[model samples]
Target: MNQVIELIQSHRSIRKYKDTPLTNEQVETIIQSAQMASSSNHMQAYSVIGVTDPNVKKRLAILAGNQVYVERCPLFLVWCADLHRLKVACSLQDTEMVAGTTENFIVATVDTALAAQNAAIAAESMGLGIVYIGGIRNNPKEVAKLLHLPELVYPVFGMCVGMPDHDPGQRPRLPLELIYHENRYDPEKAKKGIEEYDQMMRRYYLNRTHHSRDTTWSKEMAAIMRQPNRKHLRSFLEGQGFRLE
Candidate 1:
């Protein structure tokens, strides 16, 4: 395949990063790449916070379930879904912006994710490694307070970017049939695909962990689905001025 496709397919989450920090030019290029991502109506309802302060990173690491990578990485970027700027624009025109419909919330969140993925690609292309830290959502309120986020803004996720100290092989994805459909979704196709992928993953995990962790993807997914994850998210979002209505 082409270089771009090869680059994309070879993606891996780099948890262990070297102490080497990114240069100012590298940071600018990555952020500029992120800004070029397509946005819904060009609203661009998002913002990113780049943290280099050791003290702040240490506290963030603790807040994010003690993910040491958060503190260890030279650059930690918090990607936020933001509508506060839109509100300001509305106010400038003497229009009271409708702050938090569910649609608006989805748009902002998707926009943030899109921008972040672009940043990831840019970083990877530049020979840097990155990993997304969803753990930041574990303590959204404290994170928001620490970040000094305003209303109509919430942290969607954080990213750790630096030189990779080690290579963790890429994880296998589910069978294509399970995710991609022709036109109408075929339940039978999905079922068969999952069954096939489970066996593939079973072997993969066993091989990867020296037979210490012999589990299938479906089982892991079932365990995750059984528990209510981050039930506090609703209240936190509401408090952050996202009506979710």
Candidate 2:
């Protein structure tokens, strides 16, 4: 495979990091690469907050379900889906801005995710390790308070990046046959593939090093579905001034 494809396939969520810190130049380079990502209608409705303060990171770690990596990682980046800037633009043009629409919120969230993926790829290319921290959403309100976020802006997720202290195998993905469709939806074929993949994942989980779990993909998903996961997100978004209409 080509270098680009190989790099993409080598992705792993690295949790442990070395004590070394990334230089400002390297951080800026990754941010610049993220800036190159496509934005919906060229709105660029997103921003990133790089936290280097140990005290703040420690607080964030507690807020993010006691994930120590947030505090220990050399650099922690909080990706925010922002519509406030568009409001500012509308004000400058003497026009009323409709920032509460669900479409705008969706667009801003997508833009933030795409930009973060770009930054992740850039960081990996530079021999750094990174992991996306969705736990940041567990306490979105408090996180916003800690970060001093204004209305029409919210943290979708955070990322921890630093030198690798350990190497982890990439998690397995569902088969291409199950995920990829030709012309239309093929539920039967997808179901068959998933049945076989469930067994495959059963073996994977049992064989994985350290903290091996006795579960299959379907079983794990079922368990997760049975539990409430960020069900308050809609209310939190509403509190942030997103009408989500």
Candidate 3:
């Protein structure tokens, strides 16, 4: 297999990191790779904030569901879906713009995600470990305030990047056939794959090198879907000027 393909296959979410800090040149290279990611209509509807200050990271750690890694990591980044620039484009033409609709929200959010993923892959390629911090949304308002974000911009997620203190084995993924159907959908085949996957996950959770849990994929998913997760996000988005319409 090609080097890039091998890198892709061995992806892991790294939490424990060494105290080593990334050089400014390395940070620039990673952000440049992220900028190369495809964007909707080239709007690039995203901005990234790199945080290294201890005080800022401490507050962010608290705001982001008390994820200690946010404060401990040598590099922390917040990826924001931003429509504020588009408004500038409109103003340059002496015209007003409206982007509060659902479609606009989706486009900007997706652009931010695609860019952040490229940065993550770049970090992994350079032997740096990284973890995505979705808990930024646990208190989006507080996060935005902490980041000093402007209107029409929102923090989609944060990322912690640093040198790995130790290697963590790769986690298992769903069966390929279940995810990749060629001609038509196959519910029965997908169902069987999931059933088999559940057992694999049960063994994995029980046997992994860290804190062990007795659980299966299906059981975890059921528990997750049983509740309305991040229910406040709807109101939060609205408060950020993203209209559901």
TM-score, each model?
A: 0.98, 0.97, 0.96
TM-score leader: 1
Per-residue lDDT of 215 in model 2 = 84
How good is model 2 by TM-score? 0.97
Tell me the spans in candidate 1 whose CA falls farther than 4 Å from its real position: none
Candidate 3 lDDT score at position 59: 93
Ranking by TM-score: 1, 2, 3
lDDT of all the models against the reference?
Answer: 0.95, 0.93, 0.91
Best by lDDT: 1
Q: Write the per-residue lDDT of candidate 1 for residues 1-245, one digit (tens) a residue.
A: 99999999999999999999999999999999999999999999999999999999999999999999999999999999999999999999999999879999999999999999999999999999999999999999999999999999999999999999998987999877678889887888867788889999999899999999989988999999998999999999999889988
Residue 158 deviation, candidate 1, in Å? 0.7
As a whole number from 0 to 100, the lDDT of residue 23 in candidate 2 is 95
In candidate 1, position 142 carries an lDDT of: 98
Worst 10 residues of 1 by lDDT: 185-194
Q: Local error of candidate 3 at 83, Å?
A: 0.4
**Stretches of candidate 3 above 4 Å error?**
209-212
